[model samples]
Target: MKNRLKVLRAERDWTQAQLASALDVSRQTINAIEKGKFDPSLPLAFKAARLFKMSIEDIFQDEVSEEI
Candidate 1:
């Protein structure tokens, strides 16, 4: 999955560590999510959506290909 986490964080001028603190996760976890190396759990996603006041769909998307 792809996410708007980096953009959202930047818009708020929040460092990865700051965001991690707010989300109760480690900085590494936020970094991984921003880099698309890890996908957050459902509860985590919900927490993020609530934090950002956006729907989960607004934050994450399927990285589909158009090869077909």
Candidate 2:
């Protein structure tokens, strides 16, 4: 999965720690999500969508894979 988390955070002038605090997660968790190292749970995703006032698709995207 690919996400616009970093861009969104940057647009709001929020640090990873600040975002983590808003989402009730660890700073490392926010970093991992921004780096695409982790996928958020459904509840977490919903929380993010609500926080940003964006739909899930607006924030996260499914990257096409070449593997058939």
Candidate 3:
């Protein structure tokens, strides 16, 4: 999976720690997600979408979808 998490956080001037706090995750988790080294759980993805007022599809993209 790929995500625009870093861009979204940058747009809001939010640090990884800040994003982690808001998402109830660790800063490393945020970093991992931003770097595409980790994928968030469905619940976490929904929480992030709710926080950003975006759909999960808006934030996270399925790499397989791009292949089509």
Candidate 4:
């Protein structure tokens, strides 16, 4: 999945460690998610969206030619 996580975090001036702590995950997990090397679980995804005050669709989307 494609995500705006890094961009959003940047906008908030948050480091991976801070975001991870807020979301209760490891910094490595936040890094993995931002790098597109991992997709977060459903609950984690919701937590991420909540952290940014956005909807899930506002944070993640498909880059391929598939309907989201």
Q: Candidate 3 — which residues are off by over 4 angstroms?
A: none
Q: Cα deviation of 21 in candidate 1 (Å)?
A: 0.5
Candidate 1: C-alpha lDDT: 0.95
Q: Which ten residues in a row have the lowest lDDT in candidate 1?
A: 59-68
Each prediction's total of clashing residue pairs, residues at least 3 apart in sequence or on different chains, is: 0, 0, 0, 0
Best first by lDDT, ranked: 3, 1, 2, 4
lDDT by residue (1-68, candidate 3, tens digit) is 99999999999999999999999999999999999999999999999999999999999999998999
Best by lDDT: 3
**Deviation (Å) of 38 in candidate 1:** 0.2
Give the winner by TM-score. Answer: 3
What TM-score, over all chains together, does every model reach? 0.92, 0.92, 0.98, 0.91
Residue pairs that clash (backbone atoms under 3 angstroms), model 3:
none
Off by over 4 Å in 2: 65-68
lDDT of 4 by residue, 1-68 (tens): 99999999999999999999999999999999999999999999999989899999899987773564
Measured on C-alpha atoms, candidate 3 has an lDDT of 0.98
Clash pairs, candidate 4, are none
Writing each residue's lDDT as its tens digit, candidate 2 over 12-67 gives: 99999999999999999999999999999989999999999999989988787423
In model 1, the runs with Cα more than 4 Å from the true position are 65-68
- For model 4, the stretches where C-alpha displacement exceeds 4 angstroms are 65-68
- State how far residue 37 of model 2 sits from its true place (Å): 0.5
lDDT of all predictions: 0.95, 0.94, 0.98, 0.93
Candidate 1 deviation (Cα RMSD): 1.8
The better-scoring model by lDDT among 1 and 3 is 3
